[model samples]
Target: MKTETIGTATFETWTVAETADAFARDEIVLIDVRTPQEYMFEHIEGALLMPLSFFKAGKLPGQSDKRIVFHCGSGVRSERVCRAAIEAGITQIAHMEGGFAAWKAAQQPYIGTNMATGAPQRAPA
Candidate 1:
């Protein structure tokens, strides 16, 4: 991961390809900071939910050593979340560049449907 300094805030960033590769290898954990509804609309498979609206300034779920890669609609919110995590003393933190938009643009495999329904449905055959 590469480092960049923006005044008092500094965090690492990963491109879509890098993120996908890391995810494929189980090298990093993806955290989606978008709203639950937005997440339900479409999101990367296996990502943990930590919506910014209900975010707490502390360690997230899972082990401390795992790398956490935060992402949102357009990378803005996730950056804020990452900074907050940093302030909260989380060292292994990163954010996806261009956020979920880039991932969608890249046509990466994701899970979700635009239609909102509570009924249980069969998985794709």
Candidate 2:
């Protein structure tokens, strides 16, 4: 992964394949920064919900392991949260490129919603 560095933050844009592989290996903490409603509809399996609305660097989970990755419906909010973490002194972080849309597009399996019953469903079939 090519690391993107700015004044203070050092983050990387990870592809869906890379993200999934890392998650499968337990190499990072995958976080979903989308709204609760959005998450309820669909989300990455095993990803922790930490909506951008109230996201705080100190509140982030799996910081001890040193790999916390954020994602949203698209890349926008996740990147915003990444910058916020940088501003809050967490310089090293990452966000999934293209976010969940890209994940689905790449055919990476994830937990999705069954609109008819509003039940969670595993997808990519």
Best-matching candidate per lDDT: 2
- Residue pair clashes in candidate 2: none
Q: Candidate 1, which ten residues in sequence have the lowest lDDT sum?
A: 116-125
**Which digits, one per residue and each the tens of the lDDT, describe model 2 over residues 1-116?**
65988787688888888899999999998999999999988888899999999898887654677498899988999999998888888878999999999999998888888878
> How many angstroms is residue 21 displaced in model 2 relative to the true structure, after the best TM-score fit?
0.7
Tens-digit lDDT track of model 1 for 11-119:
8988999999989999888999999988877788889889999988575864465678899999999989988877886655689999988998898888756345654
Candidate 1 global CA lDDT score: 0.82
The model with the greatest TM-score is: 2
User: In model 2, which regions exceed 4 Å deviation?
Assistant: 61-66
Q: Estimate each model's TM-score.
A: 0.81, 0.92
Go through the candidates in order and give each one's C-alpha lDDT.
0.82, 0.88
Consecutive 10-residue window with the lowest summed lDDT within model 2? 57-66
Query: Candidate 1, after superposition: displacement of residue 39 in Å?
Result: 0.7
